[model samples]
Target: MSPAVDVQHIAKAFGQFQAVREATFEVRFGEIFALLGPNGAGKSTTIRMILDIIRPDSGTIRVFGRPLDDAAKNQIGYLPEERGLYKSQKVLDMMTYLGTLKGLKPAESRKRAMSYLERLELADFAKKKVSDLSKGMQQKVQFAVTVMHEPRLLIIDEPFSGLDPVNRMVVKEWLYELRQKGSAIVMSTHQMNQVEEMADRLLMISRGQQRLYGEVQAIREQYAIHAIIVEGQGDWSRLDGVTQVESLNEQRRGAVRLHLRPEVSYDDVLAAIARDDSLTIERFERAVPSLDDIFIQVAEEDAQEVRWLNRREAEREVEKEAV
Candidate 1:
């Protein structure tokens, strides 16, 4: 089957500055795909172009085997970076109106709107004006509107920006539920932890270029540290390539975080440590790079590339002016 969304060789610019450069990726059906990058990395521009909010200067976007069209648009839902609501409008009325715009009728919209409100614990605030709700409450209301139409593809940008931890969890759970129901989600966020927890796959972009895109677990494995943490009794201090060994707690128990030598095997480490029969083993597990580390490494590498490009551009400018 075709991907739920696909962007190939997409590029966009504003006047003289390119916002996105040859960005490309695909979002599989029924999976949560995350776009992670720092600010000004062309995330918003790429998203806008994909949604047809802004036409790409060059490239193609396909949704479900067809180009972006009214049918595709109707099948997708979007929650933007900036939240907006009619301050004077009742929560239910506002959401119902937005839902209606998606082709839902008054009765159907109200039914789904109330169901979402109840599920989000916002049922009590149905009659209240948007302005009366707290920031988090308002966010939930906006979320309700985003899903009221039951779109197959959901694109949410910074969905957790203003949410408190409690509400954040609420939203997170709802997103997972949507994925289980076969919704294709393309979300952009700075919260690496959330991406790690929720995203099945991710695309990392910098300066509108794709830096990394793959299954989350596979990417983590690609950058995996071939190391292990041993929590047991052994004089690991003398172990070779063991970069750091710190005490866990009492003298009888300690943990060693090892950075193995290229030729050494984990089995060798365990065998050496097990020599001391008196030493008790507590925990032994391989160390893997966290999502934060991967994100930082990718972003830092991209920043370095951008700096190099800027320097090259500067040199070209000076050479031209010299002539």
Candidate 2:
């Protein structure tokens, strides 16, 4: 079967400012696809184009193997970053109304609304006005409304905003359940940790450009450095082929990151450490960078390039004025 969302070289611009230069990716069923980028990096614009809220300047977007149409719209559920709910309305009533808007019958909408509220631990606040609930509670209610109709494609922006750790886990489990039920979820958030936990594949944009796009684990491995993290009682710095040893903790009794020479194989280092009777190895693994590390590295690189481009443009303008 075709992927749930297929965007092919879609580009969009507002006047001379290019919001999305070229974004191409596929979100498959039963997978959470993460859209990542720094602020003003065109993630929102790309999402708008995909949802047909804004048309792309070039290329195309297909939802479930066909061009997005009214029918396709019905199959999509969008939870924008901006929260919009009737503050004066009771939580259950508001959720029910939103569900009906998604094509659920009033009775079914009410039923599902209550069911979701219960699942989200907000059933006690069902009769309370939306404004009466805490921000986190309101966020949960909004989430309940978003999924009450159970669309095939769910697009959520900053889904964990205002949520505490406990509530965050609740929402995470809900998304996983939706994925298991064959819903394709596209999550756009700045929470790198959450994305690392939930997303299967990801597309990262930088200054309207597609910078990285691939399976999450594969991408992490692709950016892996030649190092090892060892936690044990040993003088790691004495190991041959180890260029540097950095302690991971303040007390110096915790794990140490051993930077290896390029020519030295990990196996050789492991063997050498094993031969040293003075060392007691408790844990040993490759030093893989986390998603947060990768995100910051890419963002910093993009910012440097942008600064260089701006300077070059300034020089050209000065030359023209001089002429």
Candidate 3:
């Protein structure tokens, strides 16, 4: 089967400023695709283009194996970063109305909205006006409105923009449930921790260009440190083949991060540590870089590229004027 949504060679510009550059990615059924980038890096612009809210300078966007149309749109749910719930309208009523607007039958919309509110632990707030709900509750209510019709594809911007960790997890579980039910989910967020925990595939954009895109685990492995994190007794600094070691913590249970040289395989490091009877190996595991770390690395790399391009352009201007 074709991907739920396919975006190819998408480029968008505002006046002379290019907001997105040749972005290409696919969101498949039953997977959470994380669209990540710093602000103004074109993440939102690309999303808007995909939804047909704005026209792109060049590209093609396909939903359900064909160009997006009214019927195709009905199969997709979009929740923008800036929500617009009717404050004076009762929570359930507002959601049902929006669902109906999305082509869901009013009666079915009401039933599904109630089910979602109850699932999200907001059933008691159904009759309450949207203004009466807390910010997090309102967020969940908006989410309910988005998914009430059970769209086969979901596009969420800043899924957890607000709310404490406890409430964030509540919404996280609901997203997973949607994926389990065979929906393709694409979420854009600055919160790498949530992306690391929930996303299956990740696409990172920098300066409106594609930085990295692949399975989350593969990306982590590709950028993994040739090191191990160990929590042990006695000094690890003296271990042979260990190139560098950084102490992460030493209070409750001593933890140290180890970096290895090219010649030092993880097995070699472990064997050498084992040879030393004075050391007790508590926890020895490979260190995987977090999504936050990868994000910073990619962004810095792209920034350098941008700087180089600017310098080249300046040189060309000087050469042209000199001639």
Which lDDT tens digits does candidate 2 get at residues 1-323?
Answer: 99999999988889999999988899999999999999999989988988999999999999999999887877898999998789999988888888887888999999999988888888899999999999988888888877888989999998999889999999899999999999999999999998898999999998899999999999999999999989889788889999999888635477888999999999999999889999988888998888888999999998899899999999999999999
Candidate 3 yields a Cα-based lDDT of: 0.90
The runs of at least 3 residues in candidate 2 whose Cα sits more than 4 Å from the true structure, single-residue gaps closed, are 246-254, 314-323
Alpha carbon lDDT at 111, candidate 1: 89
Q: Give the alpha carbon lDDT tens digit for every residue of 127-157 in model 1.
A: 9999999988998888888888878899999
User: In candidate 1, residue 149 scores what lDDT?
Assistant: 81
Clashes (N, CA, C under 3 Å) per candidate: 0, 0, 0
User: Cα deviation in Å at residue 95, candidate 1?
Assistant: 1.0
Clashing pairs in 3: none
lDDT score for residue 9 of model 1: 94
Per-residue lDDT over 1-323 for candidate 3, one digit per residue giving the tens place of the 0 to 100 score: 99998999999989999899878889999999999999999999988988999988998999899988999999889999998889999998998999898998999989988898998889999999999998888888888788888889999999888767887887788889999999999999999988898999999998899888999999999999889999879888899877788888547468888888877899988898889999998788999988988999988888898899999999999999999
Off by over 4 Å in 3: 233-235, 247-255, 311-323
> Over 4 Å off in model 1, which ranges?
230-237, 240-256, 277-282, 309-323
The whole-model C-alpha lDDT of candidate 2 against the native structure comes to 0.91
Between prediction 1 and prediction 2, which has the larger TM-score?
2
1 versus 2: better lDDT goes to: 2
Model 1: ten consecutive residues of lowest lDDT: 244-253
- Give the range of the ten consecutive residues with the poorest summed lDDT in model 2: 246-255
